[model samples]
Target: MSKRDYYEVLGVERGAEERTIKKAYKKLAMKYHPDRTQGDKGMEEKFKEAQEAHEILTDSRKRAAYDQYGHAGVDPNRGGGHGQGADFGDIFGDVFGDIFGGGRGRQSRARQGSDLRYNLEMSLEEAVRGKDVEIRVPTLVECDICHGSGAKKGSSPTTCPTCKGNGQVQMRQGFFAVQQTCPTCSGKGKIISDPCTPCRGQGRVEKTKTLSVKVPAGVDTGDRIRLTGEGEAGESGAPAGDLYVQVNIREHEIFARDGNNLYCEVPLGFATAALGGEIEVPTLDGKVKLKISQETQTGKMFRLRGKGVKSVRSGSIGDLMCKVVIETPVNLSTKQREMLEEFDASLGGGKHRPKEQGFFDGVKKFFDDLTK
Candidate 1:
């Protein structure tokens, strides 16, 4: 019987791209696979048809000939086809390589080591100005005795006998082939006859290493500094991983930071707040004098430009905001209390304190309305 068109078998357009053809074939293969269909003859035929269509369309030469002259151009009987033999394993590998972790030929067993994280706590002053700190980390380092070979001196590792150094062993499972790591070599591809004493058979040793890290200026909490190749040593002489230093800013006693800005509460004497005087405010750099205006109320904010932290990423300096808190006089002497009473009596009720007067007036109005 005449065969169906390749594009029709895969349910793809005549001018479909290679990726589109592959996707269609994958869908059909998954639907008509013998394992899924349970030995149904009809589904088996459909699977073979889809597989054949994928083989021809994926090959540039065969696809070109098929495109120009249809199946007649690729038929082995017509003496115009490429080699008719196609490995079903290769086709499955191409479609499901990532899923099963098989295919892509042989891969090296030597893999990079795992990355590590270290939490570094810094004072606010140190974070703003930047500082170099020495930190000790306990991690896996390459064994000095065997030079990461896992073997004794004057002897080396040999290829795994069972897997022939392929690192993986293929297993046949009822029309499907799967690959798993070799049990004997543990996927290292090589076996050490004589193990190193320091690290045993592992090729790496657990030890403490001290490294100096330079903290960049204006780095806040949660910032990370990467030290390349400073993490755990890789297996079998592979490349080492990285060490990430995570910054955690310690809480400051007087200052609170938000983004690049700094906020601080400044307690001012009632006389200084009312009579308008200069007060010394603290900053990261040094104490700066801030002028308080006359009749300054509590909770008033004063901004000092460029006195805050500079952003590490943007390099933009921020302002420092000081919130004034009026402190009332406490523990007055008998004479002071008498003088304050006289002073309060001398001022007409509400002339000296407008805010206090306004609040009382509102309260009076609210009570009058309630009575009415």
Candidate 2:
């Protein structure tokens, strides 16, 4: 029986570009693949025809010949085969690799490894100032003994016999041909008759690798740093994956960070709040001097410029905000308690405390209005 035109089978014009032809074939292959249309003999036959059509159309030389003389131009018996076996591997790799997730497709087969994440715990000081840290990761590495070949010494992997090194086997149901991965070779298209003893025919081994990663200054919690090629090894000797170092800043004893700003509550003695004095404030680097103005109330804030964190991204420094909280004397001796009582008596019924005096005036007004 005479074969149908390759362009007609793929539903593309004869002048379609290689990319257009590939796109059309990929859609048809996905739609008519036996895995997708199981128990359907008619669709399976169309799938085979489509595959054969795509095989001829995608090749530059074969496409040229078929376009000029039709199927007779590339017939195997007419010496028009012109590397027909090579085309079968290309199609099998592209279609089934997607179905099984074993990494197929001519371009996608050599894909880089997957990215991995590592949560790193750090102190607030370390995150603000930045640090170089050494981390040990357990991952897969190429087997030294096998050199990533998965074969024993003095021997190499051979083409898979079950799939005839095409990595797929076609099943016939009546007039249909359905292609699937070869169970023997697992669709790798090659077989290791003599397996590597070290990697056990896998060509990779588990190893704990130590690496140094530099943490930039002012990296906050939830920030991530990408370390290139620091993840797991890829299959078939592909490139290694990336490693992401995630930052988790520990809670600070004295300060809380908000973006590049630092907030800290400075403990002030009652005397320091009452009488003007100088008090010491803590920063990430060292202690700084802060003035306590007379009659300074609790929750009063003071800004210390250029004394906060320097941002890693913006490179702009932020300010340190100091909030004053007056701490009452605790565990006082009898003499100290007597001194406080005398000081309280000197205030003369809250006359010297304007905030307390004004609060009582508002309270009296609120109740008088309620009564009216």
Candidate 3:
């Protein structure tokens, strides 16, 4: 029986590119693969024909000869038997991997190290001023005995015979090829028959490393500093990963922070609030004097310029806001009580307490309106 034309079998034009030919083959491979055909001989033969066409078209040299001489150029009895030497297993992997999921294309060793995070809590004082801190981290490091080869002293890892250093092996299920990690090498592409004493068969050992970190001023919670190559050691001598120092500022006792601004409540004596005087207010740097105005009431907000934190990003300073709370006098003596009563008698509600007078007047009008 005469063989069918390769392009006709793959359902592609003779002038199709290699990419188009591969796409056509992949579609047919999925539809007519032996495993999917359920023992249908005709579908199995169709899949084989598509495979032969793909193998010939993908190789630049073989494709040129086949295009020039037709089937005679690729006859097995002649010098065209190999037909570009493309591996059918690779073609199957490409088709099935896309149909199922990706990442099955190729495999390799020398995996990168895993990234690490360390949460460090600092006081508000320390976070504001900034300081250098030393931290100890327990992580995996390269084994000293075998130099990350996972072998005994004077010995090294050898290529995995099962996969020939490919780190992967193809499992065929009725011509449906699937790639999996080599069981013998565990995907490392190497085997260590003689295990290391310190790290056993693994390439890394657990050790505590001390590192110094400079905490910048104005760093708040959720801010992080990355230390390159300070994390867990990579497998088989790959570069180490990064260590992230996450900052968390603790709550302050006297002041609360909102962005770069600082807020604090200041207590004022009743006499001071009414008569006015100079009072000492606490700040991050030191105490500063704030002058109180005459007849100052509670809940008055006072602004202190440049008394708040400096922004790390913008380098701009914020203002300090003080909310005043008037404290009432306590534990009065008999003389003071007599003086207070006399003072209270001398004050008129309308003149001395205008706010209180207005409140009572509104209450009386509300009751009068209700009655009407």
Q: Rank the candidates by lDDT, best first.
A: 1, 3, 2
lDDT of 3 by residue, 1-372 (tens): 445768899999766888899999999999999999999999999999999989998988878766544453455443212233222212211211121122134335775555555668788888888889999765667888888777889888899999999989999999699999898876878888777776765777767689999988988876889999887676678877677787877779999988888999999998899899999999999999999999999999999999998887898888899999999889999999999889889985688888889999999999999999
Mark the 10 consecutive residues where model 2 has the least summed lDDT: 91-100
User: Between which residue pairs do clashes occur in model 3?
Assistant: none
Candidate 2 backbone collisions, by pair: none
> Which of candidates 1 and 2 is the stronger one according to TM-score?
1
Better of 1 and 3 by lDDT: 1
Off by over 4 Å in 2: 1-111, 164-166, 170-179, 332-339, 349-351
RMSD of 2: 20.1
Evaluate all candidate structures by whole-model CA lDDT and list the values in order.
Answer: 0.80, 0.75, 0.76
lDDT tens per residue, model 1, 186-275: 677988888776666567766768999999999998798999988767777888777778787888999999999999999999888879
lDDT of 3 at 72: 38
TM-score of 3: 0.68
Candidate 1 local distance difference test against the native: 0.80
- lDDT winner: 1
List candidate 1 segments past 4 Å from native.
1-108
What lDDT is reached at residue 155 by model 2? 90
